[model samples]
Target: MAYKARLQEFSDTLDAEVIDLKKLRKLVFNGCPDSGYRSKCWKLLLSYLPRERKHWKTELEKQRNTYMQFIDEMIIKPGREATEHGGLADVTLDDHPLNPNPDSEWRAYFKDNEMLLQIDKDCRRLCPDFNFFQCASKHPCSRLCGKNSFETLRKRVEQTVLQSESVSRNRLGITNMSAVKRKSSSEFVPLPDGQEAHWEVCERILFVFAKLNTGLGYIQGMNEILGPIYYTFATDPDTECEEFAEADSFFCFTTLMSEIRDNFIKTLDDSQCGIGGLMDQLMSQLKEQDPTLWHKLQEQDLKPQFYAFRWLTLMLSQEFPLPDVIRIWDSLFSQEKCSTFLIKVACAMLLLLKDDLLRGDFPSNMKLVQNFPYSTFDVQKVLKKAVEISR
Candidate 1:
């Protein structure tokens, strides 16, 4: 680490906790170092850190507390009774599920179920091979509530209530929660079947995200997107223990989603900035660099989105192991270009499997591209190829 000039700058200013943004960016252009360096750099890249290092502590606290407030107000409903209908007060007699009122909040609630269910399924299945998402939290977590207890938030979470209709009102008049009451991870008590704790934390984060970003609402595959980020924070290096990984990760995920949300928004799919347009750009780039494969894929009707959509949206999480995904992210975060390197990487991957792809028809090609070509799982090698293509 000391061998790198920018890293040396980071070390020299360790006491002040300041490093040159341009230098830091240049240094990590290839990728950040290990967890301690990567996590900190990620915070900076995501704007979690202010330009003045002195304000880092204050800024981080305020943002993380705000994220907690997001959970307290949005995920957990107040003054609402928990019912069998997913925890909101029953759709009134006129506003019931059968109600014909198109403008009814109850009607809207029911409609949101399709979106919520899709998010739930994806979040639950996110990185199941890992025990962190699969098993349970090491300790039972405390709920986010007011000074005393988050009575409303607790009930809603306990009942899995994600789509309450009174979003505007609840958001406007959120019950005040104390920032000082933030609990350290050490405060948690373990449970026998503690798996619910981690999932619930993830659940609350996504739900809060949906409520806050009404334009995008919750979208499928976001869980996969959030997985590596939370994992990196939660499993930080011992020197830099993260007592509030959940809150910090929430902020980081929000910043990340803001950049990539266009990919998930269906209405924006065809816009110039949308995923579809980017796919067009990617295909064009591939044609410029690897026209043979591009023509072959188009001949077989293997459009970019068929495979690249997941590649771009989840930051390629689904196609690579968690560690490899983290490594790929290091490169993505470093590049100054609009992450076209991701597309270049994908192109390199296909070229790596050019022989097999050329031999197979659409189905085999689809299957091969959908999964990272087993021969190209070495993200390091693929990344090297990706960089050469980018150049």
Candidate 2:
């Protein structure tokens, strides 16, 4: 009965004409109700949606239509041109595949394919324990299948000859190489040519993001960050919201990325906001909260880079199951100082396993932190402990 009452309170809070974010955050910090509250709470928390309910429809339409325009300009037209021309020789005399010119469209397309391939590989393996990503979305992108549409990122990748090259590395320094080969459409088994899977939608979003943001063109773990946001919006109960899930997810993911992009940029790794600085903050917090454990870890030389790099960089998405990650994100997004609070949570995670770290050697501790024991501890407890640490 108390749970139902709290859920009702959350519903009432969200339904307010202009939401009080302070109040909303306090309610949402506990965790969103499973009955589709996250879809709205996340949008608001991420600032993708305005506080005022009256502006929602207009804002959504403008953004969704703009996203479709991006698709038409970036993906569909380029794809159609590539299809119509058949080859570089036919398309233009000046800019061929081998053109060394920086402005060459063909070069840009090939480069995008390289990034897209990496995004595809990471997205395909997303939450492998569940078939949610592999399963066909009930509301596949209709614009891509319309009379004017030419091809999607999935189709283009299968048909195009992607050059074999080393794309980029993750936080842990593992290099990813892409060697895409031409394959037939018939090879796409689970879904037919017109239909789309969840991961394909994610791939298109990341591809467009990479193209628009050339400076930080798609990183390896970006797909992991995007997966949960897309999944939350994609599974919304409201058909109208789910129909535009791709657009909604794209905007929300973009907003979230703006805040965390520094961590992914190589040049900024040691800067105040970069991953290195973040890990330093984590270690400092550990040293303050549990001096003995902090000294022990330092003596063993178990740097936060080995484990917390993935934990902090990926926002703990890779460490825990999808559901638990989402639950953790509920508290994270609600916090005013999300990143500062994240350090506190990291400290709490270590303090929770203080005994194990003290008893075990470096290898065991590395394995334990890398593969967090999510099953052993309640996520609620982790959040509560994080709160206590903050206090």
Candidate number with greatest lDDT: 2
Per-residue C-alpha lDDT of model 1 across residues 1-391, encoded as one tens digit per residue: 4557756655554335566777666666666666367777777777767767889778877876786566545543223434554334533355454667787655655554545554554555567677676555443345222232232222322234332222231111211222233332332333344234465556657766887888888866778778888777767774333556677788888988877788888777778787777777778877888788888998999977677777776678878888888888877776554356778877778788888888999999888887775444587888888878867
TM, every model:
0.77, 0.89
lDDT of 1: 0.65
TM-score of 1: 0.77
Candidate 1 stretches greater than 4 Å from native: 1-17, 78-116, 138-148, 151-196, 238-241, 336-338
lDDT of 2: 0.81
Cα lDDT tens digits for candidate 2, 1-391: 9989998999899899999999999888888989889999999999988999999999988999888767765674332243433321134466677888897777877877777777876776677787899888886776433544534777766654543336566565444545655443332444786678898889889988888888888888898899999999988888777888899999998998998898898888778778899999999899889899999999999988888887888888877789989999999899865687788878899999999999999899988887778788777778889999988
Model 2 weakest 10-residue run by lDDT: 80-89
- Could you tell me which residue pairs clash in candidate 2? none
